[model samples]
Target: MNVSEYLLKRLKEWGLHRVYGYPGDGIGGIDLALQKAVDRGDLEYVQVRHEEMAAFMASAHAKFTGQPGLCIATSGPGAIHLLNGLYDAKMDHVGVVAIMGQQASTCIGANYQQEVDLQSLCKDLANDYVVTVSNPYQIRHAIDRAVRIARDKHVPTVVIIPNDVQIKPFKEAPNAHGFTHTGIGETTFAHVTDVAGLHEAARILNEGERVAILAGAGALNATEALLTVAETLGAGIAKALLGKAAVPDHYPFVTGSMGLLGTKPSWDMMKECDTLLMVGSAFPYSEFLPDPGKAKGVQIDIEPANMSLRYPMDVCLQGDSASVLKALLPLLKPKSNRKWRKKIENNVASWWQLLESRAMQEATPLNPQRVFWELSPRLPDNAIITADSGSVANWYARDLKFRAGMKGSLSGGLASLGAGTPYAISAKMAYPERTVIACMGDGAMQMNGINEMITISKYWKNWSNPRLIVLVLNNEDLNQVTWEERAQSGAGKTEVTQSIPDFPFAKYAELLGLRGIFVNTPDRLGAAWDEALNADRPVILEAKTDPNVPPLPPHITLAQAKAFMTSLIDEPERASTMVNSARQVLASFLPRRRD
Candidate 1:
């Protein structure tokens, strides 16, 4: 046995069925090992153009499969290219293992070709990393530890294999036991014993007339538990964008999301609630939170550090949402509070009506709001939407209503740019039957969009099937940033100079052998969307939008306002335009009482 063979066998024992990455000279031995493993029915290698896309695919696989997904990369630039996606996986708490080939141990510090310190470079991007030594005896244990840390910590892990060591002849030892140990189950429920805190939380819930629940991504696995809890308390449920999949949109208790890009009903319900229960979410916007002095609040999270960090809490229970909810369910008395439920439902209905009315009445050349409305109906029931970080995210976050059966994914906490295309590609690969669409701004499209087209092409060539739609909102500038800049500078005074070249994004899609459509009007949007959705391969819809459009997050604090004002003093006119746009957009969402 060689080092590569031993490594491959260990991965197989750990139930790894697939690996994603691009092969290079440094990793040639490992690549051959993987190919041999595939021939032996142990693993399958998915060849991608960019190492970052491989990481992204692995992250999405882990997210969907609830296991540690694997990716491989060669030394130097190949390994470094995976940093962005690895960071995203870390931030999102996805379990993934990245294996990178390194320069031979002999030339590690000699500046040999493609020589780099992968362990040092990936330290911050991964929760745990180990550089494999030449001795094959330590391979099993190192891999076992890496897997355990990656899974238990809910973060990425990296393992570096030296080129020379991988191809070296080695013998399998008699006692080649792998790492499969689990932590003591007793420690898992330690946080549930806070009797005093639990009692206080129960008291608040019992006394409050209006209770609201805010769900986060951490509650995804415990969706049934959360729904049961919401129903027991007759509470209205509001979720962060990351929590979209946790509670289906059709759930009667759901009142949509909360924050800068939140729904009107969700925001209104939060404001009116006498008690707010935050479940597995560290929603960052303080302004959207209930007034601490007036409304009592309780937070349940697996991570203790997440509780009471964004907003003050009356009760903070550091326990898994499933475990905490299970314990709390027995203690909770069923409430028949129809008043609170009715109020939330009415607000949500009104908000939906307003949005529909606006979409129907809009007659602009390229009404983004209208385009979203048209596309929403045509989207598949199991469709997954990946929104880029910018104005497009804001639009989708604020207005794109997920149908009852649809599911979606987006970067919520550290919302990074250039994630849309890769996310969509990965989502499509993870669930072939589902329609995967990436909605991004023109600027964001230029960031990581090109590489993913190749990913789609490769997948299409192999599988003869691909269902990805890259919808580019070609506004020709960083609309969100420019709007904020202008808002601070009072509009006219702020000279927004940035402009994106009119790249043939649609033509690029055609060159990749995918359908391409360039749209500049609302009427053409529906047809374009239909054509793209019906295509066998991937498609890119480049919709030219108004560059002046701005994205305002759901909540902006007084401190943020002060900063904006300070920045605005330098460009008064631009600042005024931003303020005006914000005022108008907000006015449209705010509740109105007809006289």
Candidate 2:
């Protein structure tokens, strides 16, 4: 067998069945081998429109499947295109293996075309491991180490294969001075917190009058344990954006996402709490958390380096979130006074009501919040949701309610704009029987979503349950940055830089032979969602939303208020912006009027 064939066979042995990539001449050997692997039913290849989308799909595959996702790319430009998506995986701490092609080995140092130093390019993304195979025997150990390191470290790893070496005959490393042998197996982690550390954590949690729990992406698998612990302590739980699915939003004391896009109950709970229990999350914004020394903190994390990085914890336990919480449960005493939990539940109920009122407020055509608000109740069970970063994320974070058995994620750490479509596609690929939805702004759709529709057209017929839905908020503006300029930077919206050309997203989907539904009014949103969810094939549900409606923070500070007022002096849409902003702020205090 050739080296390229051996690599595919070895990946099959590692139990990886899928690969996402785009082909190029530099990687011709592997491209040829992929057909043979597919013929043998050993591996399936998904051809994406761009190498960057391939990397994003791989990252999403890892997030959805709990396995190391694999992506392949050709030399120079193709390899460079994988950087943004790979960085997204690195920042979110997901397992991914990127195989990149390089120029022929003999052409090294000759300045051959497409000969760039890939090792330096991938250094930061694959900090722990990045290797290039120079010999046929080196391929074995290189592939083994890349998969193992990525899976164990939960970070992206790189394996570079030269074009010349990829076609050479495979050979086992013999018993020689310079040869190394490797075996394939899964690494088991025995991660449990010590008894003393558990006791200390329990002690702090037991002493507090009011307790608040914060969870992140790392806590996704610890839902049952998290719920139990929150019940035992009578604590309210707050999720970071990436941990939207860590616990069900229907719980009485489960406050939704926390930070700029957070809910008011989360802000109130953190501000009033005396004890903080943070699990499997390093939610970067310290300002959103309690003031230092106001609340005693206890943290649990699998990575030793992230134990107390976010907050000054009294006891830092390094272990898996579920196991640590289970061990600490025996030591924790159940709180009999339900006062704290009751207060939290009341706040949460009020917050939800306020959100509904805001979503129902009038806009030019439709309020973006109403789109997500209407879809929240109509979501299918066991559905997977993905969102792009923009003003759309404001509605996604605050309005959509996630129930148990549902999965959701976004570009959390990197906060990239073009990930929603690829992520939803990957989710559908991984779970064909379950429905998948992608929520995007017009900016993200134009950036990458429009091209990826062809990918959907290619693969939708192969899926068992073809219920993939793409929702586009067509506001014709880069809404998030425009609001940031007004609210945070004290500058008016610059139409030259923020305005984006409008496109008929639903019409484009229909042209691709998929279902399309467009809604310009709030009254039609619920029916549009029902139609999209029940469609026989994939559908694009586009909503024409107002761009002037402000995305208000849970708590607006005096400085932010001053900046927003200053911005209105030169703001192009000052009148509409002022009217909408006032309507949103007043909606919180007044109850919704019957239509």
Candidate 3:
């Protein structure tokens, strides 16, 4: 067996069934080996249009499944393209591994064509480790160590194999890394800090009347425990977007995502609470949280550095969210104050009304929010959603509600735009039995969705019931960027850089032989979604939408107001900008509760 064969064998032992990547001359040998592995029904090499998509898909796969998502790229440009997605995985704290092909070993240091010092270029991007296989015998151990580090540290890892080394014989290579291994390796990595600190945390919780819980992806597995703790403390729960699945939104005291993309009740929940408990989520937007001295904090996380840095903590507990909660529950005193919880419940209920009103409003072209309203009810209970970064993500986070079993994600920390198609494809590959949807803005769809849609067409029939849908908001603008520019500098400039031409995305999907539906009117939205949802093959639904809608921040600052006023003054088209901005803001609001 050559090094390529041994690498595949090691990956199979690591339980990787599908790897995302693009083919290239430099990595020809590895591709040949992958094709053979697929023919024998052992593994699959899902081809991608760009190397960046490979990284994004791998990152999303790791996020959805606990295992590391894998990708491969050829030398130079291909390896360089993987950096952004790799950084996305690093910032989001997901396990991802990228195997990069390098120039021939003999030509590596001679500046041979397409030769890049890949190890050094990738050193800063890799969250944990980066290694270049210098010999044939090192392949097995390198793969084993990369996989282990990815899972153990929850960070991105990279392994480079020279083109020459990939073809070397591996029959005598020692599998020393797996020498002591047993059956299937599903190692659980837990950082349990202190079991005794639960008392201190419980004491802090008991002392505060108005308590709130801020949850992130760390709380994914500890949902029941977190909810139980919330109920005991009569607390309201607000999730970081990464932790959108931490608790079901249907729970009365649970508010949706927190940050600029969050709901009003969530912002209010953070402000009104006298005490805050942060579990698993290190939400970066500390300004959106309660003032440091205003709320006494009790944070629970496996990582000690993140314990109480965001908010002042009365007690910082370091343990797994579930284990810590279980330990603390027995020592905790149950609070009966329902006032704070009731207020939170009321806000959540009203936010829905506000959301539905905006989502259902009719316009000449469709209102983009209405598309989500149409799509939400049609989603399967177990569907997995992947949203791209843009205004479409705003619609998804605000309008679309996920059920208990549903899962979804996007480029969370890095906020990369071209992730919609790649992420959706990965989700479908990971959970072929479940429905998968990629909701994206036209800018993002045009970025890489067009390329990935073709890739999906080529392999849609490979899996059992590959129920995937791509929903494009054809608004012809980088709507979120436009809104941000307006909020920052002023609105009247016309956002020259933000404007983009609309493409016939549905037609592109149809040309690739996937089912396609184009909807421009609000009346056709429900039917279009129904058609897409019922299709057996991959489908794309492109909706022509109003680009004038603004994605408003949950809380407006004085600076934002000042910028808006200045924009109106500069007024290239003051009347038009003011009217449109007002309409957008008004559409987003609901009647406030009377005190």
Maximum-lDDT candidate: 2
lDDT of 3: 0.84
- Report the C-alpha lDDT of model 2 over 224-321, residue by residue, as the tens digit: 99999999999999999999999999999999999999999999999999999999998999888899999999998888888778788899998888
User: Could you tell me which 10 consecutive residues in candidate 1 have the lowest summed lDDT?
Assistant: 179-188
lDDT of 3 by residue, 201-254 (tens): 777789989998999988888999999999999999998988887787789888
- What C-alpha lDDT values do all the predictions have? 0.75, 0.93, 0.84
Candidate 3 wrongly placed segments (more than 4 Å) = 171-191, 362-364, 491-495, 570-576, 587-595
Candidate 1 per-residue lDDT, tens place, 1-595, comes to 7888878887877777788899998787898898889898888787777888788778777766667888999989999988877877888877788888988988888988899888789878773665555556556666776677777677899888888888887554464365233221211335454878777788877777888999988887777888887887888889887777778766656877788678778877888888888998878887787877668888898877787887778888777888877877777778885888887777777766655554543332465666687787787877788888877876776567676546677766667787777777766666777778888888877777776787787776454346778898886677676766644543433334656677788989999888889998777888898988888778888887765444444445566566655655564345434544554465466634334
Off by over 4 Å in 2: 593-595
Model 2 lDDT-worst window of ten: 186-195
Clashes of each: 24, 0, 0
Report model 2's TM-score to 2 decimal places.
Answer: 0.99
